[model samples]
Target: MGKRSMPEVPQTSGPHVPVLLDEVIAALSPLAGKRIVDGTFGAGGYSRALLADGAEVIAIDRDPSVLPFAEALDQEFPGQFSFVAGTFSELDDLSAGRGKIDSVVLDIGVSSMQLDEADRGFSFMRDGPLDMRMGAIGQSAADLVNTLETEALANLLYAFGEERKSRRIAQFIVAAREVAPIVTTLELARIIEKSIGRKPGDAHPATRSFQALRIAVNAEFDQLVEGLFAAERLLEEGGTLAVISFHSLEDRIVKRFFDPAKGGPAQSRHLPQVETAARRWEKIAKAIKPGSEELARNPRARSSILRSGTRTVADARPTSFEGLGMPMVRGT
Candidate 1:
């Protein structure tokens, strides 16, 4: 994995609004003196809010560019906040010896900050490098598209993006890349759009393909799985874990994990008749959504779904990722 050259943070005219802000805060139920982890500290929105509510915040993000923003908050708040530059999947390591966390909040998926910046290559609306890395390091979306075989590319597009015409799109991309490597977001977007003809009321023919590519490029699903398990381990008994997922894929994973029926009775292959039970988390509330007012203000909030759970006072043994029963790309 190679890191991209840090570009100057461009002056953006608008502020990066955190989606489901009020809902996230209410679900988190931050209390003074309770330590909380803002797993995706993009633009420090949730972290700042938690700090304001008097909770000790441990803000974590993979991108180092957000460090200055978090650092500034640390200076202002002094001992109230701390920033760790790493993925939330490593929360266990980051929180080692700090005592069990009281609450953990993860606003999954790419942040507005990442999409607004053209140089980051997260959005097709802007012309930028073909990179779609959230951490800004590792093989980018371009690398995968240009190098993957037609079959692999098709599978990635279908599995990650949920594109119905993944085969056609992959064939078009593979043929186009033969002439020259796809290096920019617009070029790839055009290729996908052209392959899949626009529909009457479609927003963009390339939208789903772009999303699939970004999700694959970032390995978002894998990270989410790891982060969820890490949260289960980090949260103390009775601690809350709240997650707001922007898409069905993410929401499904969160929903299944928080469901009590998903996990079956554990049985060892050696012991054919013996069975053991495994339980880690308890669901707190049903799926939550933003109000119509929120949707009017930010259309992106329309698809967001919030789910929460509490760590139960059961055995704290680690469980297999398969046991969680979350939908994820195999071998991801």
Candidate 2:
């Protein structure tokens, strides 16, 4: 069968707009003729920008649903873009023998497309099935909500979402599910809302719990830690690594990876000075947040943060999860 052309994606409303785009491009200066990687490739926003700047882009996404979007990019850019339907953790192998990569960019957390599509079950805005797998295959949110013991569920919420009322919410869910399975996104949202009363104008009570479940379903943190190592291995000397993370947990992981002083095995202030080995990254910049103008244009950009660093000529070190400081969640 002949391959059919994909219709151009219409400009849509909501948080789909890439946040802090100009800042990201500036950080990745001298884009022309560079080979770069866009690890998330959500909606192809960053990839489009890179191609426009005369870069050869290798873009990846775990979600098969993004194939159409990527196909559109292929049609527009021809030889300038290549899309890989896989996680970024394998980026080293994906780019192997392709020669040196100039830069790598990762946008962490759920994309606006996922959240906006009710059928995808990422948001509680409109009731949908309790499934939050980034890719088509995996345990669904319903599976976790229905099966995990009350204590285990509570721990997951507390560890991942930092929800203080995790115990109460977990108790409520367990009791409710005993009657019948917690099947839909709203069903669980209601259970959480009832357990933790919401006040006027407060964020949805289900927000944190949903986030925790989505993270677990996608194994987001594990992928993130591995992706960091993969990027380090694929980048050439003086290559740039930029990460835009939306929440505190994601930001902390990036911070720990880039700045040894903030994360990982901490050095003792009292101990005598010892020479350090060649580091994988240098020139870590302060975290950059969206400006007022950006926030006004896109309210969703308020919580977005960008952190970046330049790769050094040193050999990539063994990956470490210790520096990320994530509380251990069993069976994630």
Candidate 3:
């Protein structure tokens, strides 16, 4: 598993430099004959790198717009690459018949390509439809903004976005929607800005609220917990599980999955260690943040962390969503 300069992963896609590329490649240590699953294919960055390393890759992404990228990878790698258009939570089923997967890599959260395309409505920097549904299958962000109760909306912002001014923002949303529907990104962005005034150098006032809406509309936290469990069941003994998360919430779930104590306080010597399920992962890396060089080149990698582990011979056990530090949004 020698490190090599990665080739550019390009398509008609937008600015998407895969975060922690060298670290991820080093963590998985892809071999020529090994099979790996790129659970969040995004713009095919990971899959292309793995394919270039000569590993057989199966990529999964729920966004149908990534089909062009997938098609290009499939063509470039031929037999060594395959694409699956489905959610990563059901990755095991989506990747069925790919025998004895040797590794699975998940890059959690929204893709840069999705954010760059204003039509997809993932970013407030540009005005687009208020839709943030990843696969065109569920309620749009506009649906939630237009219909969810103020309390529920506030809970959503507080839970998912970690926004301190959730109630005020939610109140503004309700009051504005009463005048008319909040049907566009700018419309909602204006409400948030009006409720929470902007500072001279701070980020846009709508950043947290938009992040919360995207998570709620797509159920990202739940999807992440399930995907972790699915990877547990999907990997064979000694397989690698590598995850790159851009936020604390996603990183916490990855940490708890690798840690035996669920990242709780250390057990005191005075008390006997309580019996827990047999260890499922042997961690090789924990909370490895981007280097200054990487951050300087790609500022989007600033908040990202890479955590990886090797699968053990033990059996996989049940996963608890709430136990993993995932916030429950009270039916938002």
| Number of the top TM-score candidate | 3
Between candidates 1 and 2, which one is better according to TM-score?
2
Best-first order by TM-score: 3, 2, 1
- lDDT tens string, model 3, 248-327? 87888889878857676777889998677678887667579988988888888899999999999998877666467878
Model 1: ten consecutive residues of lowest lDDT: 1-10
Can you give the lDDT of residue 64 in candidate 3? 90
Off by over 4 Å in 1: 1-14, 260-278, 317-319, 323-332
Model 2 spans > 4 angstroms off: 1-15, 264-270, 330-332
What TM-score does prediction 3 earn?
0.96
Clashing pairs in 2: none
Score every model by TM-score: 0.89, 0.93, 0.96
Instruction: State the lDDT of candidate 1 residue by residue for 130-215, as single tens digits.
Output: 89888878899889989988888887777877888989999999999999999999999899889988889877878777888888
Instruction: Give each model's whole-structure lDDT.
Output: 0.80, 0.86, 0.88
Query: Which portions of model 3 miss their true places by more than 4 Å?
Result: 1-6
Q: What is the C-alpha RMSD of each candidate to the true structure, in Å?
A: 6.6, 5.0, 1.7
Ranking by lDDT: 3, 2, 1
